[model samples]
Target: MKQSEIKNLSLEDLRDKLAESQKQLTDMRMAHAITPLENPLQLRAARKVVARLLTAITEREQESLVENGK
Candidate 1:
């Protein structure tokens, strides 16, 4: 997913996507370990997506804390 698209998602939506992406990354790793993926690049892509999602979520949380003076 593009950063712009991710940026538009609500906090709850971002959380859901982050969870789904993490599961996909785990599944991809397990499958790859058992047998090489036809496209190993899929693993790399998934990892990057997970990282992006996590980063976005963290940024959002930090922003909220700052705004609330927490």
Candidate 2:
């Protein structure tokens, strides 16, 4: 997913997506263990997407905290 699209997702949606992505990553790893994937780069791409989503979430939360002065 693109960073812009990910950032547009609501907090709940982002959390759900994160869970789903993690599950997919686990499945991919298991599959790879049995037999290497045709495109192992999928794992790397997925990881980067997760990281992007997380960064957006953290930044939003931090912005909220700063705005609230808490």
Candidate 3:
């Protein structure tokens, strides 16, 4: 997903997507260990997506904290 798309998601949706993406990454890793994937680049893409999701979540959390502090 693009950063723009990720940023548009609500917090609830972000958490749900994060869980789904992490599960998919784990499955992909296990499959890759047993057999070479047709496109190993998929793993890299998946990792990046997870990172983006985490970053977005963290940004939201920090924003909330700042708002509450104010």
C-alpha local distance difference test of each model: 0.95, 0.87, 0.97
The candidate, 2 or 3, that scores higher on lDDT is 3
Q: Residue 39 CA error for candidate 1 (Å)? A: 0.8
With a 3 Å backbone cut-off (N, CA, C), the pairs that clash in candidate 1 are: none
Residue-pair clashes per prediction, in order, are: 0, 0, 0
lDDT of 2 by residue, 1-70 (tens): 8987986898778888888888888999899999999999999998887888788778878888999996
- Stretches of candidate 2 above 4 Å error? none
Encode model 1's per-residue lDDT on 1-70: one tens digit a residue.
9899999999999999999999999999999999999999999999999999999999999999999995
Scored against the true structure, residue 32 in model 1 reaches a CA lDDT of 96
Q: Which of the two candidates, 1 or 2, achieves a greater TM-score against the reference?
A: 1
Candidate 3 structure quality by residue, lDDT tens digits, 1-70: 9999998999889999999999999999999999989999999999999999999999999999999999
lDDT of 2 at 11: 79
Better of 1 and 3 by TM-score: 3
**Deviation in angstroms for 69 in model 1?**
0.9
| Candidate 1 TM-score, C-alpha based | 0.95
